[model samples]
Every structure is written in structure tokens, then in C-alpha cells.
Target: MASCTRKLYHVHGFDPRQHLEHYFSDKPDMVFEEDFLIFPIENLTKTFLEGHIRGDVLIDLSLGSMIHHLYAPSEFFKNIIILKVRDRCILELKRWLNTRTGAFEWGHATQLHINIEGKSAELQDKEGKVREAAQHVAKCDLDKQNIMDPVVLPPADCIISVFLLDCICKDQDDYVRYIRKFSELLKPGGHLILIGVINMTYFTVGKDKIHGFAYDQDLARKTVAAEGFVIDKCVTKKATGISDLVDHKGVLFIASHKEK
Candidate 1:
């Protein structure tokens, strides 16, 4: 089991496209669509509808090259800054942002956002708004004092991190440390939206089996509180799909704010 488990950065076989398709694509039989795409989308839309998370800038530190989670936030925030850990993930996002040939089609995600909001908007227009709102994407190193070192970033009003900690953290302490780093990127009163897996030990990206820290909701709450965050809401959805690609028991979503 130890030999099979690989750290995220060391997994050179990680395929961004395959990763997206396996978990996020609009497939008829894909079980992950509900957990990875719909669950976050619905919860995020609900949070945004409550009018508590809007701001001038929102920083996203998500796993892979996913943009599905940003659809609702794009409408509420004036600017979105994305920080990616890998150059491949950055290039994958840029392909869609620049509307280059062979970019992964996200029309399905855009349509889902529209349908959930019960609003009248064309898919192309909604996609454009999300693209426009995403003003910057840069590589990040969580180990550094400044995650985006040499490129000083202003404190954002909100930060959304999806499934990143699970992939990067090797233990409970690492999770706590990363959460503290996340808080530092936000303004004192800013919000933090986290969507991650629960009791997940590993997940597959292409042929690589990357390590995931198995954590429960209690640990998440305690970690966030210990890092100076006040939890406003916490939601969990049990895994309804059976797949060998990932061993996650459920999905966890937390909406919290840094204590001022």
C-alpha cells in the first residue's frame, strides 16, 4: 500500500484532462458528477444567494483544472484569482480561458449553474462572465511564506479551496498548517469556503494513485477554529456512488469566516 501511494507533486503521470473527465465531465453513468460537481455547485449557489460571501476579490485554490465551482462566485465577485500548484493545471485552465482549440467544453457546467439559479441567461454569455471575472492564474507553493511568492497578492475578501488540502496534506498537522496559510491570504473578516472529501485515503489521476489525508468533520472544524476561523455552516453528503478510483466516504463543505 505504501509503494502504491504517491505524493501529488511526485505523480508525473497525472493527466489533467483525464482527471477532469473522470470526476467532473458530463457523463451519463459518472457517479462523481453529483459529489464533485453538483454538490459543491448547489451549496455554493445557496451560500451566494444568502448574500454573505460577496466581495471585490475571491481567491481560488482548488484541485486540478476545475472551473465548475467558480460559476456562482463569478457572478458575485468582481475579480477571481486562481492559484494552481502545477504548470499543467495552469495551462489547462488557460486553454479554456483563452478559448483555444481543443479546450475542454464546460457548457454543461454553465448550463447547470443557470438551471440552478432559475435565471434566464445564455450559456455562452455565462461562460464569458466567468472567464472575464477570472483575472489571473499563477503557480503557488504552499510551503513558502507567500504562496504566490514574488507576486504579492492583496488580501482577498473570500477564498475558496476545493479538495486541495486532501491531496496536499500528509497528516493532521499539515492540514492545520495549510488552513493557517489559507487564512493569511484573506482579509480579517473575509470568508473561507472549503469543499473536500472525508475519510479519503487516495484518489486516482490517470494512472497515478495520489495520497489523500483521511480526516473527519470534527478535525476540519477544530482545525479551522484553531486557525482563527469561525465556522458558519458545515454540510456533508454521503458517497452514493461506488468507484475504485477514489475511496472517499463522503463530501464535506464548510463555510467559515476568519475571526476579526
Candidate 2:
């Protein structure tokens, strides 16, 4: 199995370290440019935002490399917000959103944040309604998106669910749950910009082994549609150097919007 995995890596010219650094770099410009798979997402997002999604809320569930884009605001979203429900890093997001101390400026309409690692908590407003929470929180699983540590805001106009599926979902059923969580956050007709690795991605994130679900462009579209979303645009591109240390081939997804 290991040899087969290695063969697969060479067949695809996968280089894990480079791929990981491309998306995790602190500097946005430092993002990996060689990989064409991610470019389509950037292009598609820019294209969709040209004039169609002005003033819509953008909720980033996975704050990995995607966080870099938040620095450069796009025209599609009226507000760009982030949610980190992981126990250890939850404070990092909270501190980022707490602009009152001049630490970091959201510049957007509002910067809402929460950390639910220690408590069995749910986000409820004054009305006692179980507001929308982090839908992709994975725990004690080798392959899942762990965001359950915090319960953030309710559903909004848009939710940007990035490579989260690779981390939080293992099968189609798990995918359904994650998608439902994201869907609940949006009002009718809300928009969603989802990005995910289209193939199995397994790598050593530090000392822990993280496994990704085998994703493809077609499956992505089907999953999105199953969640009551209309596919507005879809893109797929080739990936390079993603099988060595962090074995992930590439990313592909569609921009879906719920109809009112």
C-alpha cells in the first residue's frame, strides 16, 4: 500500500511540503503560484464578486491559507468574517476580531467570534433560538475538519466553506452534515463559495496525521446541489507537487447560491 501510494505520488508529481506552505504562509503574496488548481477558485471568486454579491456576508469556516485573502477584501462580500472553533486557536480568531484594542481592524460591518472548546455551548440569541453554529467541527477523527470548539454567529447572507471538507468529512453522510451546517447559516438566496481538495489528501500536520476525503469536481457539484444550492459557476484545474510530505493533489468547487 505504501509503495502504491508512492507510485501515485510520482504519477502526479506531488510534493507535500511545498503544497502545505503554499496555503499556510502568513504572507498572502507567499501563496503557491505554481498550482493551477487553486487559481480557478481565486479567479472564479473575483469573477462572481464583480457586481453580483455586493454587501453579502462572507463567513470563512476554515482559516488556513484562506485567511490570507481576507487581507485583500473582495468586492463580492460586504463583510469578510472568520470563525475558528478549534480549542487551541479559538483565541487567535477572537483576538483578531477584537478590534477595539487596535490590535486588528476588521474594517467590515461587524466582527463576531466565539470559542466553545471548554463548554458544551450553543449560539443562541435573546430569542433562545439555536443560532447557526460551526457546521464542520471534527473531533477525535483522523480525517475531519475540527471546528466544534466554538459556536459562532447564526447563519448570514453568505458562507465561505473552504477546504473544510477535507478536514471534517469522511463520507457522503458526513458531507451532508457539514453542508447542512453551512446552509443553516445563510438566509434564503444567500451565496456560498466552497473550496476543497478533489482527491485524497493525507499528510503530517505537525505530528498528527490528517486524512482528506477523496473529492472530485463532479462530486462537489452534486454535493452542493443536494444541499439545496444552485450551481452558479464551477471550475477545475490541474494540480502540481502535492504528494510528498502533505499529499493533496488540488482543489475544485462551485459557487452556489440559495434561491429565495
Candidate 3:
């Protein structure tokens, strides 16, 4: 039921409102009932407590409020790093995350947001608004096939590469490369927790091709396992229902680091 501000940014002759309504509307039903700080479903928090990880890094690709909303207070990791493609969705997501205008700042302010969505007027506009506030926002477009780039931040104990796989990739190779970069961003024995939509029929975000990556779940699982990650859990369940904003069948992968 969260209202999104992306409806106003649509290009001419493109009314993806209905399409997007189905896209943005559906969410994890547990989202509202579970407090991320103490949520049991989060494998990262559970792994951190099991003494499997210890370090100064928690890279959050596709930086959105959901992950932070769940893990920020836990401080399970020392430093949090965020990466995202520069699009209206991410920009809106960042705005919601950065709106800590209360009397106190609860979490550490060491988090960073790297803008990796290539160049476009809409993307430029989204970045322009957030550039001043996010000190570490980077200018790289994963859609342009630059997934092998080096990590912009230091190594971390865990990398919560959630919801980014569906956004940053246009094909299998790009998806593999992006996951490699995500792994490279972490130190060995670190963890990776990823969530993405699988078996999606189609996607369109205001005249933009935002959802045509042919999300091969089996191939993706094999690829991540090949990237020195141990497959702890891969859950593919039908969401209880569809959302009016966003539409797609989805899957989740919670991966841990392999001891080399």
C-alpha cells in the first residue's frame, strides 16, 4: 500500500501506470508484520549471529528501504554499502530511505548509494536530485554490460544483493558478471542474500525495457554456486497474491560464502 512517486516521470505516449501498478504494488506480505530488526526470515541476521561472519562491510545493492528497514537497527555489520541503477524507481526508493527527519539518527551514517544506472534524461534527473545528498553515488550503468567493474567500497562480511539481479541485468552473462562483482565486493567467507522475480511474462516501466532479462532461476542458481558461494537456501514460492502496482512470479536466494 506504499504510494510511489514514479507515475509523474513517464515519457510521452507511454502510460505504463497499469503495468507498473502491478509491478510496484505486490510485496512480501510479511513486510508489514515483521520488524526487520528482529525478523526471523532474514538469513543475514541469522547468519551473522551464528558467528559465520565478522567484518566491516554489508553491501546492499539496489538500495531500498526494505532491507534497511529490516537490518539497519541490527547493526549486524560494521559498515553498510548500497548500490543501485540510476532510475526513477531507485531515486524514489532512496528518497524514502533518506527521510530520517526525526529528532534522532538511530543507525550508523556510513552507508553509501552508488548510482549505476546508465544515462538517460529520466535517470539524469533522478540522479541530479540525489547527487548532493549521497556522497558515494557512482555513475555506472549495469545495463550497458559493465558488471565486471571493481568494487567501489571496501570488503564486507556480507553482501545483501537483494532485488538487484532483476534490475541490473539484461541477459545471463550480465547477471553472472553482476553477481561476480557482488561477490568481489565481499571478503571471503562473507554472505550473499539475494531476492529477484522469476518467470516474469513481461515488464515495462514507462516506455523503458525494465523487465525482459529472461530470469533463468536454475541457471542463476548454478552461476552463483560457481562464483564461490555455497547455496544455503533458494526458495521459490508463489506469492499469496498479486499486487496492483507490480506483477510477476518471484523467487528468493539466500546464499552464503564458501570457505576457500
> Can you write out model 2's per-residue Cα lDDT over 1-260, one digit (the tens) per residue?
34334222212223333333444433445334434223533544364545565454567666332233332123344455555434334433343333235222222111111120122333222001111222222222212343332544445777766566665666778777878777877888888777666675564443344556777777778878988999988876666645354566776756778867
lDDT by residue (88-188, candidate 1, tens digit) is 98999899999999999888888888888888999988888889999799888889998877889999999999998888888898898999899989999
lDDT of 3 at 194: 73
TM-score, candidate 2, is: 0.63
Candidate 2 structure lDDT: 0.50
Q: List the residue pairs that clash in candidate 1.
A: none
Point out the higher-scoring one by lDDT: 1 or 2.
1
lDDT of 3 at 118: 20
lDDT of each: 0.88, 0.50, 0.47
Kindly indicate the candidate among 1 and 3 with the higher TM-score. Answer: 1
lDDT of 3 by residue, 112-222 (tens): 111111223342233234333333434344434343265445666776665556644656887788778777666777777776656553444544434435575688789
Residue 171 local lDDT, model 1 = 89
- Which model is ahead, 2 or 3, in terms of TM-score? 2
Give the winner by lDDT. Answer: 1
- My TM-score estimates for the predictions, one after another, are 0.96, 0.63, 0.60
**How far is 186's C-alpha from truth in model 1 (Å)?**
0.9
